[model samples]
Target: MPPSGGSPVEPPSGSEGGVMLSDVMGRDRSINLFAGFLRDIETAFRRLEDSSQNTTVLAPLNSAVEKLPRKPWEDPQDYGALGPNAYEGGEGRERAQQNLRKFVEAHMVPLSPWAEGEKVRPIGGDRELWWEERDGAKLIQPDAIEVVGIAGEVANGQVWIIKGVCHLT
Candidate 1:
């Protein structure tokens, strides 16, 4: 387990001896959107688990999802005549999954024990994110979003539940 600004907590069970991303997000009840995102990328998470390098994930909670620009696939009407579940299989599913993978990757930085005042590039996007401490509160990409609560460590990395989705501008 990673330090949470204090003593380390016990790692959650079923984490393959490493802290899983789902376990970290599970601790925060408000991170439903991020949890869903993780579910959509189960394969990616598995790959992350297999890697030896440490990673840092910047996850957006429910409120952050609400603030983000809506994606066409998120709306049932956007599914056209095929229905919402149309994206569940076939080429559409592949494309949608690819997009989701990119979105999730954009929020992840390949570093562990990320510190304050560090500018890091995301794994899926070109823009750089910085860790900022304002008024004694820790924040990542202060110009883009706010950190909701304390950071938690998982088996391979740290998780920061952020308040808003970040976009590459």
Candidate 2:
């Protein structure tokens, strides 16, 4: 967990040598709300095994969850009350999983080590994302959410911890 009432954690400079995306996300409490998204990313990586295609993950922190619109398939009553695992092993669970996978994929790109100020399209291909650098901090666009940290050297690619959700517009 980050220190209370202080600036967000900054991503380490350069690759830290083969850190899995799951491990990276697990260590950060700020983005714990994105557990569902992280799991979906892991699922995607498993599906694409042995593929050398690197990826850039845009991981949203807890606050971003509040910004996302409720999905039609989601149970409105359980929206914020449920965790990613809550959607497992039940009727419509498969659909929920699929939806989650699509959501995570939409925010990812098949490019690693994405530099600051580079404009690239997400895997979803619905909109473009700009990796803007501001005051030595990296941000992903639509809302200029700062990347608080980064975990590199994962099996598939890298994970970037963004301050908020990247709402598709």
Top model number, lDDT: 1
- TM-score for each of the candidates: 0.71, 0.63
RMSD of 1: 8.4
Q: Over the full model, what C-alpha lDDT does candidate 2 score relative to the true structure?
A: 0.59
Tens digit per residue, CA lDDT, model 1, 1-169 = 1101222233334545556554665567787666556555655465455436677878788777777666512434436756666566465566566666767787788787787778888877788888887786666774647787755776677778887776644
- Best candidate, TM-score: 1
Cα miss at 108, model 2 (Å)? 1.5
24-121: candidate 2 lDDT, tens digit per residue: 65566666656545444445544223235667777777777656666423544454566554455553465565555566676677677677677788
User: Candidate 1: deviation at residue 61, Å?
Assistant: 1.4
After superposition, the stretches of candidate 1 with alpha carbons farther than 4 Å from their true spots are: 1-18, 72-89
lDDT of each: 0.64, 0.59
lDDT of residue 160 for candidate 2: 78
